[model samples]
Target: MGGHFQGARERPNGPRQRDGECSRGAGRNRQIHRGLCSPSQFSTPRVECTPTRETPIARRCPDAPMRVAGQPQARSTVKSTVFVVVLVFSLIATGADAQRGPDTLGKIKAAKSINVAFSGDSLPFSYVGEGNKPAGYSIDLCQRVIAGIGQAVGEANLKVNWIVGTAAERVQMVATGKADMECANTTMTQTRLKDVDFSNLIFVDGGGFLVTVDAPINRFTDLNGKKIAVIKGTTTEVRLNAAMKARLVNAQVTTINDGSEGIALLTTGAVDAFAGDKIKLIGLAAQAKDPNKFAMLMEDLSYEPYAFALPRGDAAMRLEVNRALTKVYVSGDIEGIFAQWLGKLGRPSGLLAAMYLLNAIPE
Candidate 1:
């Protein structure tokens, strides 16, 4: 239930792009559905859902008898209430599906390479590693996905074209078939699912405040009037705003391009606090020139589930990615990855690992 997500801002080079942008399908502008893109608009263009039986209908009926035609008699009444509930729930589910991006798997296959988009800045999850190559948990997971594709196509060396992008462009890359997969710290939210598909939950993240060691704020409720730093187009922004609104708290929000810029602002005292995912904040803090100057508040505001994103139509691709993640979780590779990248502060507990294991599948 914890993760990171990027933004929706345009890149400097006109709009951020990968290999090439695909055309947008109708009803493709809604928020994500079920933590992925709309099923109708597949970023991969290679997947389709064949309907199957769902949960059994819960049935109820009126207990009271009514007189009809001037006669008192017991009559069986099939209540319309059940239908109403079903209709309402179905609409919710359908609305979620409508948010998914169109199928793009066919387009991706024709293009030959399975293009993957990722945030070039989210280190240890998706970032520039040695040789300026994309490396992190998501990157490694994608490598396994590439292996699956090689097995499918009988190409041992299936090529993976890595495209560096921002949070704003991640979905568009998949939605338009510019890239077939997204390997960033993406959160699973209903709004994002409408535009692209997400793989299994790769990591769990919680929202917290990042502040200078000397700052006075120590709790989620303490962010009043204080300029809080946040990234644009991310769940951190959405949830922080929502929490503030719900709690009747007010704070000035400053949107930055990346964590580095955000830390710069904090270091210069341009803002009172930096708000983001705890893991990411810790990463930034560890790499800071003087790590002792900042600390993450222990109190959390929300939990988010991070997952890999793909175009909605590519169920095969989604499944393949999920399978690889499952292997990582079951094989204990995820633990190792966390240790290598995030375990310095503290090793993830049995509870957190159990949660990851239980909800390993994509929503």
Candidate 2:
């Protein structure tokens, strides 16, 4: 009588009741009262109902749906979903950061060593020297770079592990993490920059033809219908093929493994002439059995700007390499290195001297 059914009364004939009417009885009457109160009709009752401890009543209408314990409500479910999404994204970001790994200097400090890839057969630039160790003009420049790296990492006695490979293989080693950097007569081209970074210009050379002194070849036009030998996977090879195509020369190109091989092919008459960097060809011919027997053409086929190759996107390593190069250039040490490995060939040309002067960056 004191609850939401204060204005209702029991029907004398049947248990059915109209709106705002409820039966006030026990047992069967209470069941009929519960069935008659629809949730929508009693969702917002004007009269308040206070149930005592002896007669506990549900806060909602009798016909309202019941909630099982521990089930989440609609709003709570939305919040939980948002939280899960945020956590997943956080984990993904963490994984991406982990994959970035460490920088070049950190790796060097941890390993206490640096790996350098070089060409074991390319003379003057890089080659297997006395005692089967790596030596040459490029190797000397690389040693200065290594010394700078040692200073950066605070390791006065950093070990140098020289890995010998061809030009293509040396680039691959630097790109794939097998070596930290590659020191060779590697030319810096727009195409090679896609996979690796390069230091300042180290040397300047041009692609040219090397032929027997008595051979009939004198210029680019003389290469027509002749078999030319070049080292496989070199810029000279690509430039030679392009020059032949541009000149409309029908020449057969034979690829060899290294400078020595090209020299062998040309010496044996397997090819009419060998194509390579003019400076390297001169060094190779000088090492031949009869240096005077070979003649290098005066024609320049391609301009080659040499540099050291490092891992792509590694600005720190590149800076150190260039710093070392600048130091050598500015301190007059490069002249000594050039004279030691290439003095016999003659002094650095005017173009090469200008290259050194231009790349000597200030501290």
Candidate 3:
């Protein structure tokens, strides 16, 4: 097997959130188990990226440090190669940027319309609602962010042009200033931090699998060599790839555009399982024709702290966004948003409550 996971900071358990905040639930502050819908399943996969066995293996000679022609890389070199491959991917991801404009808040003020990128199918967070209009927890938070921006920028009625895009498109859109903010359930990770900035932690989540009850997989070990489906351009994909690689799972992975396709694949038996944020999987499963047809693997593939992706280097705009979020947290408005969207799934966790108290800046 490959080397163990290193340098990954698991979102702590217990009162994992900051003090003065109420916990959304008792445990890791996972998604409310909402039968949440994510537009991710609805979109056409914008990009497909994965190594046949992962190029990192090639980048780092995991075999012998010095190998003869045609000789396999020695297992002794595996540990070092694991770190090297991870580092290389990190460098490459951060180095390539869209060269986003410097002043995101200024651009918004000048344009008189702050364009916020939102997912088209991200349920309970951001998604298309009645009449095809955008709605969800994150979308509402972005509206609140706009209110904070309007207050900061001296525009009481700043126009917010909702820009709907897929997960792959939203990061570049924000980094390039095509969108002022990505108001969706996007996890902030070291690789992505290279391209765009992130707001204060809004939601903490982890990976879960949705498999047909007929062939249920309760944990990671069962997924070995299984055919799995996940949407492209998501942290879920990255985590899944890394975890599978580290565990040396010879699983066949398929990428799709949206959650719907993933569900269809699971239903149609195109793949063995559909994997995503546990909350998102719950959302997909909830909406499935047979809610009882699917089972969620309790095992977590990785920790996901969801935040808004913003333009790089625009701390002011980020602060404005955070200030809006802080207001929401301070005023205890988040519970209502959660109720409005995710309440159907379950009650908010104590950890989620703590997230607001921790992130809310008194000053």
Candidate 4:
């Protein structure tokens, strides 16, 4: 063994050559051999091949990272690669499952009756008409929409299911699908869109102040410290507070049930002014025993765009309703519906006509 190592050391670049054939003075490169045998090894030193043991040297290519033979990292890399492949396939399968089928449209088609939520007190838009049934301009517009749906579904005469609700109540009814669409005086505000979608603009109104003709108030500021009546759960209640704070009109607010209640409060001197939509203020005032006894403030507080509210994410139903409304706007039927319900308030303004024209969807 000693002699063999001595010969190997003489040719340190490689194992010793055959007898008398010395690697020394030979201008040839040498190759690394893992077959070198040894009972024990030395760093960067040659070892003799022997029958007792074998020596395996872990080698790395020049400029390449060092790796050990029989190491566990290779097995780990294979496992990780397989895991990534499986995960990609699983994600694609889940995505395929997510393609939804029919929803609200199918339910409505199966029921064969379009459920409608109308307001009991929002006159001219939707209100309790003859025999306490739902009727108004908005209701008539919704009827036209239902007629279209009836034609599409081949029902020809689809039945109507009325669900009378207030402003806040109607919003919940539509969002939960308890009502197909709310044909009420619901304003199309950004905040409301979180829960439901609105059709084209139906009625454009703004906050107006109502006061008895004999009241000391002549302007908004005159109502300071005066009791103001507003309908509870309506946009007017919120707008009334906001307007009072912004203008420094420190008036006391009283929330009532409906316009009729506000009118009653005005007659009893319980409320100094009734604040609500201009159209509604006039509607309430026109119903008084003497129409000349009350007056409405000329200035508007905020622009309120009323539209029909429907269930959120029901694109099919919303599209059908919009198509029906657009057809009405293009035809001459809208004018008659407005005259029948809102003629007492006078003709539609130019801005109102523009609403119909702009929202009249083509095709």
Better of 2 and 4 by TM-score: 4
**Residue 221 in candidate 4, Cα distance off native in Å:** 1.5
Query: Per-residue CA lDDT of candidate 4, range 134-157, in tens?
Result: 887888998898898887777777
Q: What global local distance difference test value does model 1 have?
A: 0.72
TM-score top scorer: 4
- Would you give me the overall lDDT of model 3? 0.77
Over 4 Å off, model 1: 1-110, 359-363
| Cα error, candidate 2, residue 256 (Å) | 0.5
lDDT of each: 0.72, 0.83, 0.77, 0.77
The TM-score measured for candidate 2 stands at 0.76
lDDT of 3 by residue, 1-363 (tens): 255544432333444333322224554332211122223433543222232321122333233253322223334356567778888788777665433337777777787778888888777678888998888888888888888898787788988788888887999998777888899888898888899999999888778788988895777878897999999989899889998989888899999999889989999899999889888888778878998989888788878889999888887888888888888888888889888878886886777767777987886
Q: Which stretches of candidate 4 lie over 4 Å from their true place?
A: 1-57, 60-102
The collision pairs in model 2 are none
What RMSD, rounded to one decimal, does every model reach?
26.8, 11.3, 32.4, 11.7
Q: Return the TM-score for each candidate structure.
A: 0.68, 0.76, 0.70, 0.77
